[model samples]
Target: MKNLKLAAAIAAAVSCGPALAQTEIVWWHAHGGQLGETVNSIAEQFNASQSEIVLTPVFKGGYEDTLTATIAAFRAGEQPNIVQVFDAGAATIIGAQGAVIPAEDLMTQAGVEFDANNYISGVRYFYADSEGKMVGMPFNSSTPILYYNIAALEKAGVEPPKTWEEFESIAPAIVDAGYIPLAQSHSPWIWTENFHSRHNLPFASNNNGFDGSDGTKILVNNDAIKMHFSKVKEWLDKGWYAYYGAGWGDNQTPFENSEVAMWLGSSGSFGGLLNSVDFEFSATYLPYWEAITSEPTQTFIGGAALFALTGHSDEENKATAEFFKFLSSTDVQKFWHKETGYVPITTAAYEAAKAEGYYDEKPQAEIGIKQLSLPSGDNSKGYRMGFYVQIRDVMNREYGRIFAGETDVESAFNVIEEEGNKLLDRFSKTN
Candidate 1:
C-alpha cells in the first residue's frame, strides 16, 4: 500500500510538470502619458506570450531624469535590467562599456539571432558601432519633419514650403493671415542637431563622429549652421516665428491652439498631433536653405534606444534578450508603429505595414519614413559627442541669447562650439 502511494505521488508530480520560474525583469523607461501606456501594453503582451519572463516597466521621468535614476541605481548596485536612452546620450551610454552589455553582444551571448540588416536603415545605424554592430535596440526612431496647418497655408495662398526661400516668402502672408508662421522651440534639437543633418553639413569632424572617437570636437560655427541661426533670428524678429521652450510635443501646442500655422517637430508627434488638433494639417520634408543645398540629403535620428544594463544574472540577460526578440518581431513593431507615432524600427515591419496599406490609410504618416529613407551621407548618419547633455545646455543658453536678439549668430555660434568642446574633453578624460 505504501509503495502504491509513493507511485501515485510520483505520477502526480510528473503530470503537474516542473514549476515555471517567473523571473522578474525590470525595465526603466522615460516615456510618459499615452506613450507610457503604450509601453506598458507592450510589456503586458510580452508577459502573456511567455511564461518564463515577466517584465515590469517603471516610468523614470524624462530622458535626463531616467539617466540620473539609472546611474544612482548602478552606483547602489541595484540597477535595472534595461534602460532607454535618447540618441543624444547614446555616446555616453556607449562610452560606459563596462556598465552595459551592448544589445548585439547580449543577444549573441543569449544565443539569439540579431542581424543589423533587420532594422530600418537610418534607425538601426544610429545605435550601432563603426563595425555596424548594434549597441542598443533602436526603440523609437524619428526625424524632424515639417508639419503645417493646411487651412492657414490655403488661406494665405501659400503652398507648403519646399525651400527656406519659400518659407521666407510665405512668412509675411502667413502672419498677415492672423497666424504665427512658425512655432519653433528654443532647443538644440531643431536649431542645432536636426539643422546640420537636414543640410547634409557635418556637426562634428571625422564623418560626424561615425568614424569613432576621432571626431570629438564641436563644429557648430560652420557656415550652414550660422546661416540657419541668422535665419531663425530674422524670422523671430518679423513675428514669423514664435519660440517655445520645450522639445518634442511642446511645439505641437502652438499649432493646435491656432497660435502658429506651421511647426517643425519630431515625426513621433504624428499620432499626438492628430489627436490634439481638429484642423486640416499635413506633413512634409523639412525645408532646406536653397542657397546652401537644393534639397535634403538625409536627416538624423531624434529618438531613444534600448540598452541592457550590466551586473545582472545571466538568466536575466537571457530573458531580456528574449523580450527584445519579441519586441523586434514584425507584428509587434507594426502594431507599435500604428499605435504610436514612431516609425517602425525593422525593415520587415515597415514592408509589412506598407503591404497592408498602412500608408494609404494615413498618407501624412509616410512623410517621416520618406524623410529618413532619403539618400544617406556621413553627416546625416548621426552625431557622437560625449557629455552631449552638457553641450545641449550650453547651446540652449546661447540660443536663448539669439532668440532674445542679445547676440549675433556668428558670436553665438563661436561661444557654443568652444563651450561645448570643453565638456566633451572633460567627459573624455573622466568618463
Candidate 2:
C-alpha cells in the first residue's frame, strides 16, 4: 500500500546510516480552522512519502494578511518559497517584478512533471497570464452561486428564478410571505464584479485589463450598472434584501438561521452550510440580466491560488516546485475536493470524482463545473485589474452608503466610478 510505503520511507530515512538531509520548503497560506488541518495533513503525508523533502505549510492569518506578510518577508529577504494568494491579489502579485517566480516556470526549472491543460478551465484561466499560460498553481478556487431555500420557494409557489428580472418579480411575494427574499454578502463581488461579468459587461476599457492593467479606464458607469444599483437600492428600501455587514460569516448566518430564503454566496461556503443548516437548500447558476437571456454566460472564479515567491535559494525553490507537483497530482486534487467544499482543479480529478457519483449526491456542485467550463468571453476569463483592492474598498464603502440610504444610487455610483478609476489610473502609472 502507498501508506505502508510512505511509513517505511520515513522510518528508513530516520534510521539510515547516513541520515538523509531533508530539503525544507515553506508554504505561506490563508486558510484557518479545518482548512488548516487539511493543509497540515497534506504536508505530513507528502513528508512521509519522500525522504528528501519536508514541506512546511504555515498559516498566516487571512488572505490580505498572508499577502502582506509575504511581501514584507520578500523585502526583508525572508519570504517563503510558496504563498497562497486570493484572486483579487493576482494582478498585484504579477506586477511585483522579480519578486515572484512564475509557477509554471518554477515547475519546469525543478523538472517537475506538469501539464497546464490538466487544470479546469475556470481555475486555470484565473491564474493564467496574457499568453494563456498558468502563472501560478490553481488551488481552492471558487465562484459565487445562488443558494435558494427549497421549502421557502415551494411555500411561495414558485421554483428558483433563472434571471435577475424573474428574481425581482418573485421577491415581493417572498417578502410578503414573511421570508427575506435575498441575503447578499457585502462586497462589489456578486453585486458588481461578478454580476456585470456574468451578464457579459466589461469592467474596464481594456477588455477588463486582460490586455494590460496600464491606462485602464473604469467603464462601469453605464446604463446597466446604474440600473443594477437603482434596483439594489430599491430592494434595500423595501426591506426585501439584506447585505452581509462587516464579516464573511454574516451572509451565511442569515441563510442558515432561515432569516433569508435566498442567498448569493461563494460555492466554497457550501460545505459549511451543509453542516450548519437544518433546512433544505439548492445551489444554482448566478442570476443573469434579462438582456442576456439568449444564453447563460460564465461567472468568475472567486477564491485563490498558490504562487511561488521569489528571492529563495535554488534548493528551496526546487523543493517548493516538487511540492507543487505533489499537490497538483490527481490523488491530492481528489482529496482536496472531497475534504473541502472547493472544487477540484484538474479535469482528471473532476471526472474521477464524477464517475464515483460524488456530484450526483450533491446536485448543487454541478453548477460549479458548468459555470466554470462555459466559453471564455471578456468577462468570463477573469479580470486582471490593477489596484483591485483599492477599487473594491471604494465600491464597498460607497455602495454601503447607497444601501444604507446615506446617498442616492446615482450619486454613490458616480463617486464609486470616479474614485475607482483614479485608483486604476494611479496603479497603471506606478506598475
Candidate 1 clashes between residue pairs 3 or more apart in a chain or in different chains: none
State each model's CA lDDT, in order.
Answer: 0.83, 0.82
Instruction: Give the CA lDDT, 0 to 100, for residue 57 in model 1.
Output: 98
Q: Estimate each model's TM-score.
A: 0.92, 0.94
Q: Which pairs clash inside model 2?
A: none
Best by lDDT: 1
Q: What is candidate 1's lDDT per residue for 1-431, written digit by digit as tens?
A: 64674465446545646785567899999989989989988997786676677799999999999988988999999999999998888887888758888889999999998887888777877887777788889898888888899999989999999888899998999988999999865368776777787778888865666555543787888888787778888888888888876454566687889879988887888898888899988899888888987667777678899999999999999999999999999999999999998988888988999999989888788888888888877677778888888888888888878888788888988898888887777877865
- lDDT, model 1: 0.83
Model 2 agreement with the true structure over 67-94: per-residue lDDT tens digits? 9998888888898888999988988898
Q: Cα lDDT for residue 196, model 2? A: 67
Per-prediction tally of clashes? 0, 0
